[model samples]
Target chain A: MPKLFRKVREIRNFLRSFRCSNDNSNSIGFVPTMGYLHKGHRELIRRSKLQNDLTVVSIYVNPLQFGPGEDYETYPRDLERDLTVCEEEGVDVVFAPTDDEMYPEKPTIKIEIPGLTDVLEGAYRPGHFSGVATVVLKLFNIIQPDRAYFGEKDFQQLKVVQRLVKDLSIPIEIVPVPTVREEDGLAASSRNTYLKEEERQAATVIYRSLLLAQKLFSSGTRNAKDIKEAVLRALLSEKLVSKVDYVEIVDEEFRIRDDQVMEGDRLLVALRVGKVRLIDNWRFGDEAV
Target chain B: MPKLFRKVREIRNFLRSFRCSNDNSNSIGFVPTMGYLHKGHRELIRRSKLQNDLTVVSIYVNPLQFGPGEDYETYPRDLERDLTVCEEEGVDVVFAPTDDEMYPEKPTIKIEIPGLTDVLEGAYRPGHFSGVATVVLKLFNIIQPDRAYFGEKDFQQLKVVQRLVKDLSIPIEIVPVPTVREEDGLAASSRNTYLKEEERQAATVIYRSLLLAQKLFSSGTRNAKDIKEAVLRALLSEKLVSKVDYVEIVDEEFRIRDDQVMEGDRLLVALRVGKVRLIDNWRFGDEAV
Candidate 1:
């Protein structure tokens, strides 16, 4: 069974004690998540376990990442179930800190990644990426893991982390895991539980639009405008998806790829299914030009 | 003699190899500076040598911290002299990377500490503190020193770093060494080299103003306005001094202390003598409030 830590102070001390122990060869893998564990989270933990001698998972629904009128208060969290899943998955440690513990003082330092952060979700929710970057940095400092795992479901976030680590010269490997999806093609999210019966089924449109864009790109449509238009059309076709937040076809770096869809370009879609917002993305094109 | 490493990759590897050595109890103390070593910098190195098993110093004039018209190009640098000083001080390693080594990619992330950073030097030079914070954090990550030394001569910078380490939970102790001054009370600074003979002699007014403020507060005067007015009079009395940039009384944290003078509150003064700018500060009142 994995040991659970509630306080940042305790967990930090525990990690430090282990670090100071003569075992210099031990490699720690970290998986940061907001609770309500599902099959997707399990895959991340399983990957961490396979790659490192010790695996640490942090489950804290960070309040800083949510803007005003966002679903921060309504975010799902179940510690008991999360602990059970961690134990069953053979996780080494689970560091879950309270909001007060995580943020003892209002963090004055705002980590703003200008061009990369200000698009897509950043446009829809201002100051969101900064919050994510700040908290993730704080967590990274505390854990000091050998290799940290982040799922590409949050494609923009993964890219931001990659840029931050490289730009700052942080000596840790950032391992990107492919997005984990449900059998129905809907990207598994804690918010997916927020959907009502009919809304749950309609949420698949978010994934469908991304897949459709990828299919278009695979079928020899190089223009980003056409791919994005096709994605918007498919998403809006679902009546239960009340709104299309964004349908962007950008290169790996999140810059707008309007001229042509080259290799490793991404097709991203975000939509509102009833009251719940869903997001999904897929990479298109080959490695070569 | 301390070994000199000019590449980020080589220095990081050297540090990591030392970190993994069987002597797990060894503590590293770091003092980061932009070259052109002086008495103030030597004091920081001396303190680091006394405290840790190994002491590392980084000498790189960060371009990111300088404004458009600022003196980045004219910044004094004598690596041979700097190496001699490091050897005299018994330094362990010197990490001196070029501009390209420090900033390979244009950093998109701006680490801005809003309320704390927007005043003082920040007001005079926009984006200066953000650049300082960013580079300092990068150096701290690269060194991973157990304790870091910072001189209180750059008082605002010391406070910002303290906040960054605390807020980010960086597990390194920040030791603030008292400001080293010349026999004439002029604060030791690299910019001091910019002053002509007459300007150098006249620049004592900056230090004099701070002393006068301390005298008034020490003599039982409590009004901030009175303290500031007296400081301004003293600074302007020197004919060679060109302009008074700022003469203000602030608390330890750099916030305006408008009311009664209290213990540990700082009186800060900045002025231009010929083409060179000088700054100095004096703490008023006893340690106890």
Candidate 2:
């Protein structure tokens, strides 16, 4: 493991120097996160190590993405613990930039997906994807990674980032890793730590609902409305799941589905367990559904 | 003049190639334009050539920016004429890409500046700047120019592009050139050709209002509202000026101004002459206003 300093200017200068270095055979892969490293992040770093000569991991809890009432300040953060995990995972560089370093000046530009953003998380929290798209694009430019990894737990965010890269013709290739789940099938997230013991137990219904829907889809239940209804019923059964934001069966491009589970289509579900919102999705292939 | 043939596999391929080439030198200056080259474009090319080692001019009339009822099909296009002018200007590369070439896949990504966009041209035609930002960002990546030039003729657009570059940290310097105008003070544009002889003569009010605002600001007119009112009155006087879209004195960042002209403040004016819309602006400085 190569230990790199943790400063934005230093990291940028280092990248510039590396570009001019004599070593022309090394390729760098980057995985950007918002600290509180988990198994999902470790998996991303592990894949980066396996594929590249160097791996860079960035941890920034971007304030721009959080709404007025959202958890910007209260969001989980632990640099020391994150660094240890990164070291264990063989990360070559850990770029943890300060807020000022990331945004020297106020950002006036915004990236927005109109119709797509007006639904799901975007509907719940307006301007969320715009913030995600802006920050992710900024990171991609600064890192100039040959490849970057994003977990599919934030399926909508992953889709938005993919669209941004495709639309803007960003040079970096985005590799979306599968959503890492707990043993109980709940999608692993940094926010999952916010759940109380009983709330944590009740959070299982989110995954349970998704699993039930998946099972239904596989067992000759192809109607999207029925699956959505079943998932809603399962989530409502859990007292801790205060709100069912949306349970959608969408096509690969995130377009809402009708009656059938076409091969390669995805079923995405989002639910608010206490104060924490968790999202997960599973793709249906011909063999499975 | 170095003419290079670009066989772009994708926009990313183009960006990567440019990045590798740019790292070895100061890189080229870029001027992106919709085809239908006129003397105004030549002026931009001249400025680009003077400022950088190489000049790259892109001729792409992005379809995304055009509204449904807007003159997308009837929009002026003359690639052969544009090529002749570019060749005469000693442009290093002329990136005349097909719509298919520019958007290989359907574009799902959109970039928008809300408050700023909700007014001005964005107010007139919904989602215009989103399309402009998306295409401009795509071109910025494809060309990877050290400095990109945008005419102040479209003041709102210039501000939006500047914001995009700054907000995204897109490793390119944005250089806003002065609006090139005809002898009658009409701002030159590719769309200028759409005007009939009478309408063309009447189009002078677009710049006339801007000039009036500049004159007032220079003559110790410190109040923004007063200057705006003066410009609006001047534009409204012209019978051929069908609609006065907006006339405002704003700060450099496009924020609405109240009182006193800051040294680096800007005065923007926009109006419709017959069916064509035109915009212009002037910076408040010793030599400018």
Best by DockQ: 1
Q: Which pairs clash in the backbone of model 1?
A: none
Lowest summed lDDT over 10 consecutive residues: which window, candidate 1 chain A?
A280-289
Query: Whose TM-score is greatest here?
Result: 1
Write candidate 1's Cα lDDT for A242-275 as tens digits: 9989888787677888898987988877789998
Clash number for model 1? Answer: 0
| Candidate 2 residue pairs in backbone clash | none
- CAPRI rating of model 2: medium
The per-model DockQ list reads: 0.70, 0.58
